[model samples]
Target chain A: MDVIRPGSLQDCLRILKTEHTIPIAGGTDLMVNLALNKISPDRIIDITGLQELKEISLSDNFLKIGALVTFSRLAGKEIAQYPCCNALREAAEKMGSPQIRNRATIGGNLVTGSSAGDGSVAILALDAQVELTGLDGIRKVPLSLFYSGYHQTAIHSDELLTAVYIPIRPGTSSFQKVGKRNALAIAVASLAIYSYIRDSHFEQIYIAIGSVAPTPIRAVKTDLFLQGQKITSGVIKEAARIIQDEIAPITDIRGTADYRRKLIANLLADQLQQLSESKN
Target chain B: MLSCKINGEEIHSEIPSDMRLIDFLREEMNLTGVKEGCSEGECGACTVLFNGDPVNSCIMLAIQAEGAEITTIEGIAKDGKLSDLQQAFIDHGAVQCGFCTPGMILAAQALLDKNPHPAEAEIRHAISGNLCRCTGYQAIVDAILAVSQRK
Candidate 1:
């Protein structure tokens, strides 16, 4: 395979538009595919050279993270300072390993569309939007609506995921994942919650789940149920019940369908319990 | 052609840039110290320093390192003297079959370069990527901690 290191974003877009070349960043997932003979491309465009997509900036309380920003940066101390970044940062910390995090990119994670991907699920809970840049122009897609099916995304072959925009809101967020082991294990199930809790009641809440569906999904019913509800053990249990039915987990090597459903409920309860206890 | 620095030496190669960084450093440049136990990234046997950060060289393209500095196992010793890390690995019995020693040392080196004095947990977390089939991680962690303690 031939590799083209595009000097500019526009140049990369032009090549992607004109040729059947595949765009690669980090190459963590793509390399695995290559090793397994899953994808054999004639030409590959290394978009890592596009420096514009490697920055993280905040303006007007909205954080724009470049697509090439590795997980190491997202989970690093610098990003942990952002109040709205807690969930994303937590997810980055739980992802793969130090070596894998050093190379994996948020853009690559979204495009790979693993239901259990740390970055995607965490960003989903934060109600983030992905920026897709193509030869025509750039358009934003709500991360919730980005995935079409298992291992599939809305990104066109000619388009590249340039950046992710996260709305910075004042709240506490947390992410949890159940894997075989603490490090270097794919998630059996994971959950992330972002909320503004006052007097043990949720003012606003967003919940997202992964590894239980074909795509990482927003826990809409559970979120709506928990919103404005008093944070008690009873309410937490009810929300857990609501989420078990809302998610569509499968029996995979990582976990059984029943086990995943059980995990979601427990994860939700554990996170909500923390908030309730903190109020005491 | 790709121009870059490997093990403190400036070099250029016209070989296909699509080759894995591990293959480029080993087959093309003869830097076999960058092991390739698992072509996939699951095993840390192919870890190397990419611009000072440890990464799975097996998963990276040689073209990706066109202008970046790379450090492999060969880069650890300077002027034929064993780096402190290498000496610690030996003193602590961190080596067994030795297949994982190179990757382990490089991964530990990257961690030390970033945080010279790492806690035991930090040392374990840093080397979590590099797995020694010998399952002698306690010694490896001890060796890394010893080096950190010495400094």
Candidate 2:
């Protein structure tokens, strides 16, 4: 196997456009698969050295996180202290362990396209936009449309994920994960909720779930049911029922399909009740 | 060929591009103090200080450390004398099987480097990745707390 360390983003783009290589940022996930012989790419492009992808800046309309920003940075006080990005911070802090977080990048986590990824679930709830850059140009795709299937994404072979843009919206957000252990365990089922409540009603809401589907997905039916609805136990219970039907979970080593369905419904109901009480 | 500062020494060698950092440390540099229990990032047995931050070396390519400073278990002691944290490990009987000691100490060291006087919860959080099946973690936690209190 050959490895190429590109010094700049332009150089990386050029290499990515011309070569048959796998771009490795943190290598927390990729290296594991490589060692297990699950993937055998002939060339590997080390993208961790790209300075442009290591930034986290708040713009007027969005909080732009660079692609190579490690989970440790997101879990740190610098990013976690931000009210708008707190759910994402919670997800980052709960993933793996300190060592894994230090080497795991948000970009890598999304690109892996794992349904068990906590970061992807939170990003989906945030209604974030992914920035993909190639030799031709750049395109921003919504997180909802980014996943095509299990372990597959809309990212092209020649394009590099440049940044993730999360809208700067004032909302109450929460992240909950049911992993086997507190640290270093893949989530059995996870949910992230971001809601904009006004006058004790849900003005806008987004809910994303993981490990209960082929890919981390938004609970579109549940979100639509809750939008513009009154903050009441009856409405919350109805929305929870809608969420149970929205997911297509599978029985795996982590959890059973029936258990996940029940967990999702209960988790969503609890989060909705909490949000309602707090906002009211 | 890559160049990196290991154990406070600037070393340049022709390491394989595909070699994991843990293998490079143990095989090429003879730094066997960095254990390879899991070979994956889960166990944290291969934990080392990469640019003053603890990371699982087994999951990292040796080429990735080209320009970074790496500190393995061998780097913690100075001039054949164990650091205060390492001495405390022995004093508290934190090394039962001794396999997880190096990684635990390095993990704790990374935490202390950032926060010298860490709380008990912080110490446990710092070494959460390094699992010691023998000592049940009380001794390890006590060892780290002792070092912090002494400082």
DockQ winner: 2
* Pairs of residues at least 3 apart in sequence or in different chains that clash in candidate 1: none
Steric clash pairs (candidate 2): none
DockQ, cand. 1: 0.86
For candidate 2, lDDT tens digit of each residue in A82-157? 6667779999989999999999999999999999899999989998999999989999999999999989999999
Candidate 1: residue A247 lDDT (0-100): 83
Candidate 2: misplaced stretches above 4 Å?
Answer: none
The lDDT for every candidate, in the order shown, is 0.90, 0.90
Tell me the lDDT of model 1 at B141: 92
Query: Per-prediction fnat values?
Result: 0.86, 0.86
lDDT (Cα) of model 1: 0.90
How does model 2 score by TM-score? 0.97
Task: At residue A139, give the lDDT of candidate 2.
Answer: 100
